[model samples]
Target: MKKTLFFASLMMAAQLNFAQEWKPVGSHILTPWGEKVTAQKPHPEYPRPQLVRTNNWQNLNGLWKYAITPVNTKEIPQQWDGSILVPYAIESALSGVGKEVGKDKALWYTNTVTLDKSVNKNNVLLHFGAVDWQCDVYVNNQLVGRHEGGFDPFTMDVTSYLKKGAKQEIALRVWDPTDDGPQPRGKQVNRPNGIWYTPVTGIWQTVWLESVPKTYIVKTKQTPKLDEGVLAFQATVAGSQAGDEIKVRALNGTQVIKEQVGQPNADFELSVPNLEAWSPSNPKLYDLEIQLLRKGKVIDQARSYFAMRKISMEKDENGIQRMLLNNKFTFQYGPLDQGWWPDGLHTAPTDEALKFDVIKTKEMGFNMIRKHIKVEPARWYRYCDSIGMLVWQDMPSGDLGGNHWDMQPGKISGGNRDKARSQESEGYYRKEWKTIMDVLHNYPSIVIWVPFNEAWGQFKTKEITEWTMANDPSRLVNSASGGNFMETGHILDIHNYPDAAMPDPKIFGANQVLALGEFGGLGLPIDGHSWQQKDNWGYQSFKNKTELLERYKQLIRDLTRLIPMGLSAAVYTQTTDVEVETNGLMTYDRKVVKMPEAELNTAHQALYQAPTK
Candidate 1:
């Protein structure tokens, strides 16, 4: 009877925790998913989908103590503000503290974790999926480490700071200057206007802790060589001994497909008997298992996955440059996805919410998406790879003040002005861009590396483009999109508002793939679903849903015509309405899908059926 009463008490406590709600603190608007959010369990999914471990991890995404303090404050504040929902930026409404931490103030967060035997015995790793600008992390009042990037995940080995059978305290201090600082912030400004949106501050992604063995496989770099029918694997081991061997196995569900064993931190290859290339038509992925063994005993293991895909450029039957998937001519078309939620700024409200956007794009008969000047969590790309959606990722632009915005670069345009950034700012840009590439290099969906957009913070064009191409020769490089037209990249992209238009084939067709990087921003603002109370904008505005659907279909028809004109791909304005921009197929709140899915899908199918010009 005592044991039964104890179990009942525990159940009651769990129910109470689950019932703790967190209402959005903003007046702008709220998404459907926002209402479902709770302070006790926010973004409970495993943060990293690409690199997965079955167990020995804990989610630390519950309510956290947050305080906005002076920028130069070194010590922890004596007073603490109310609880804030983590994984949501402090500036975001979903954070439960819709407070701004400007250049002069730093956002502080503190939390405690009750360590069990499992976490205390093994080497502990604390991971922050992403934190804006700069941050200093502390464990038990000792400075653990510091990170500078806003979009890349950072991990710190906290095994040394662990106290067995005791509560481990974690604290973070974050500072972001927004547009005032020369970082790749991607349309984030203190003031919200036509193009720029609200700023994101502090932690905007998942925070978790994992326990690993003393000697474990830290990372594995997988490169599927489609032409050779072999998968290249490079493993990096931490705390590896002299006799440790790394075992890599590619599995088809439960069946072992291929296996290879090599020394720790070495390279090896596994050949597939019958290679199935990954494409939009058939998205085949092989499950990967990596194990670290010492003295022929399994000491560490990690689960991962990969796809056999090849992306390149080739000339079609008409001698026109085309973007090829698996060495075949397949036109890529999708939206210029900004990846913003009404509740969470840089972060998605939930894992389901993140996957919903990609699923909708695919269901709408799109094969690709141009991820606009913002980076998403790794799981977003994993969904694209799983569901067969191509990605053109843009490097977030910074230092926009010094550059000139060239609306259009006509044929034969050569020399153009470049942004003159400080040496410190330029170094930061190079470091962060390389880091972003390193973190997202494994995903198969990413086909193109776009270094600049609309000439924003464009500097040393030829040099940067060449470097980007050389760094990853496997993927194509789009140096600039709709900016100072340079004759250096694989794809020459142009942005034409409201209608579909490609780069002039006579000049760029011979060398680069002609693509309409952005167009067809047909907008319709639903009366109650709009972000703004009065002012809202789109490239082309409409009154009713019927009118919006008609204009969108017309734009699709115009896009089909461009396919025969050597146009490789086209990106519509957006996936959802963001801030005051009502140009999306869905509204800002994700409550209303502007056009019917079937109608949009039917119109989009015509473009894919067209022959290459």
Candidate 2:
């Protein structure tokens, strides 16, 4: 009887252990970092790199109990299904809960944190790196606030939500209609096939808590004027008195460059002497220290960095319009980077994984990346700025109903046949586009703003393009990337699939630069790395790596031929395979290298050589 009882105990213990072990739930392709994920710590890095605060902050990105219920339900669930990974979208494999939450269903998350009394004495601020669609945040069951938008970051002051103890309970309720709603969701839908992908609901980025002084510098905007050798900046203050002043300091690796005094919420310029211009080949960044002062005493301080660079257009010796970086013509060649991960979707699994694509693109001899129809986390752009990779940012497309298109080089008309949009839709586009631009404007890598892509939600072509150009005059504007021919923007762009092509200079030679926005989607699907086994496809499919490489090399050779014809820049089809689209330079899982990097780099090098005068 005793032996029997002991065996029963062992069996019970084993069962509980098995139940608690964390494992990814989906069978889709997974990245290397995804394979190594656990419930302990995920993406444990400072989420905001540009605004660095090293002390009095905590990471809340481990496992959290989650539930999916009908959207009509409001009460918190008495019991959770299981632990889902925080910061990974619920539909993602890395979330450990590959469950779909539809438009009729609402997703929920709950976690607990132990507040440090030493730090909690200061004002506590709750930060959600990003949440999909719409969400309501609660601390200790009290409603703190609400937010809308799937891409940008939002924060709330939750100090009042704290109780007398060290522990505090936080909850999140999220609902995302995905493609069902007319929002800025990029290629995500209820049905997953072709270019559209699985819906991402709930928290998809780092969630954390920080303590700050009552009077803190909430945000800082920096614009560098290299020609004038000065950095113009402005700071937004949260809680401040009338006489509060601001102190700014610039440093180049411990050597002080400049220091100045300015008032909060006032425009000020700091002289940067002996400044080195930032470019693709030579990226230099200067560290910045900003402090908020009250009566000559420091109240709040933050750290940041900046780069001195300029983007413009110039007429070359051949009397052709050319895109110039720092007053020099450097042909921008890169991939149409659709920022997606097999494991995390919009959010990358790790910081290192996030930077991997940019590093590989640079290695493959690409100077620029057209961030396609989607916005990435701020860190992605920061990495590009640090590594000196140029960026052309595209506003994510929505309500995309318009005429079909063909790459008509040198077309005189912008084909101004834009989509007829309702007033609500037009206002939504304008507001969101402006907000996105304001958020990402500080990054020096983004040289161009692509307002529309392939006529997707292309409306008010002249007005939108002109507004974009006027608002950010520092960078050249590609108003429509491979869309309806527009006469308003700086570049005349076109898209052609699976082959090298370019806009003709014959028609618009004097006014606009000619560019091939997209081309060369050479696809090779390895058996184990694909999202789906049987139905995967690319714009142009190849049987093996050898054939893919040869075809890719030939395309590169053909692209070089267009340079003398006033082709200013070009973008390849994509950086990596996402879901059913198997036309990536790298595999979805990122394990297989379809083409030899050295050979591809060699081919890409010839495109950037000096074109004949």
Candidate 3:
């Protein structure tokens, strides 16, 4: 007892030391939530919302020992420079080590965790929400797993590496090439300027651990079949025997509506009576309880939820394609949301901070958001789902300096030629995109998938578009938003600056949904909230808030007129200012709202109520 007490005291003293040493390292503007961050527990919430095991998991998101080493140095370091806040990039202010780790250096993180061996049933799984570029994970100095791709979550089983003790050591070595490599890094550059922003390195999302039974449910796909009034449910079990079964129960606020049992690794169709279709107005969600059973005895279980929603396309009376939600035409209008923070960079400061943007978007009376070349954390999409906000998810653009971005009204000659990416580059793109889709397949808020944006790294456009459609036929695929105008996919999207416009209805409106993928970049940079004091810019700079509001209202009026002329959707320039680009409804720090949300909401009602052909 005395020895354990002494060890506990030592640990407490060490934690206090770390708390005193850790501080946000930059002078850049910070959001209200960023200011509240501490080294004790940063983003301590459960990382995986989709697959919830309740208190059976642990968040590994506090300060950890970090070191910057030369790229050629493969051995683990004997000495560490200082501490870094886990799940934040080294370049970010919240990491407390605001130093850039470019292509020439590797970022190393190491930490110790205490595992309750008695409670951890059969297997221990180490999970990373995301790690930028490439990473190699070690468990007690043993190479447990290696993963690439900066956006997708990867898991490794670290049970075998455990000695017969509660304390386990974890280490990770990460290397991100940023722009030097052909990976799908979006808007990240070593020398950030204009539209591009700071380069993010190493871990930028939640890292955690989950303990589960020997036979556990890895992931489940819950697709809402609205037409048939059924939910197509499938579970992927990790370890299973022939008799192992999965019992699924659909609940409505603790009341079980329906239940079904099926063999592990098989599909189960559950009848949903009186379906309340999820939409921008009424986002109804149903709870789920899945249990893994063997010989009619429950061993493991998880809780999750899903919404019944459908997205499709149909031609109107004038033979113009129109996007339909739940078999009804709903004009979608929203901002181009680039999920970036001045403090955390790619990661949000807290879960509440992450949900704030989505909540604000819905409050502004926008039905949809074009996630501009950036994928947010899963919690961001969950907030969108619950708050009745539609999302158009874009694949992060990379492999630049080799593509044409022609967007002439009548002619798209320059964009016809695609970038010739090398074999490795093409392979990386394919693998990462598939992984991202697989990870985010269960979210209902995502109505559209944008494979490429503005001809950036666009290669084999038709092939890629067809594969995307075939992979998930549940959602519409925008081939390339404002990129090469290919006769592919379901939408023909274009971009116009500071004005609301759509594709020529007489030309491309017959077979495709006419959409203004980007427009209305009216900029008004507030004095203190601006990323940089001078040289801030937008497509059309405004002097004051009143002027900006007037111009934005005019753009909405123009966009309303296009709705009747076969215009299906329109995405404004952006949701918040990013770096030197001062074209956002809100400032980069999220401190000030350029226009009143009530007024913007009232003005946007006209576009949704506009008559369609």
**lDDT winner among the candidates?**
3
lDDT of 1 by residue, 1-613 (tens): 9999999999889757644645679787888788788776788888787778858888888788888889999897767877788899988989887888899998889987776555544588999999998999999888998899888789999888876565888999999999989888998999989879999998888898889888777777788788888988888888888988988898887989889999887888999767788987798888988888888899988889999998888887777798888888888998999999888988888888999999998888888999999999888999999999999999998888777666563353445667788898888788888888878888988999999998898998888899888888878998889887777889888889877777777767879988888998888888888878778988889989988888888888888988888998889999999989999989988888888887778888898899875
List ranges where model 1 is wrong by over 4 Å.
1-22, 409-413
TM-score of each: 0.96, 0.94, 0.98
Please, what's the RMSD in Å of model 1? 2.3
Candidate structures ordered by TM-score, highest first:
3, 1, 2
lDDT of 3 by residue, 173-197 (tens): 9999999999999999999999999
lDDT of 2 by residue, 1-613 (tens): 9999999999888646643666788778889987777777788888777778878788888888899989997877777778888889998888888899989998988887777554554598888877887899989899888887777778999887788788889998898988777666777889987888888888888898888999998888898898899999998898779999999999999998999999999999999999999998998999999999999999889999999998888777878898888878888999999989998888788888889999998888899999997888788899999998999999888777655554465564444578888886677578778878887888999999999888887888889999998888888899888888867899988888877877667667678988899988878889999888988889999999999988999998888898888888999988999988999999988887788778888888898894835
- Sorted by lDDT, highest first, which candidate order results? 3, 1, 2
Highest TM-score scorer: 3
lDDT, residue 502, model 2: 71
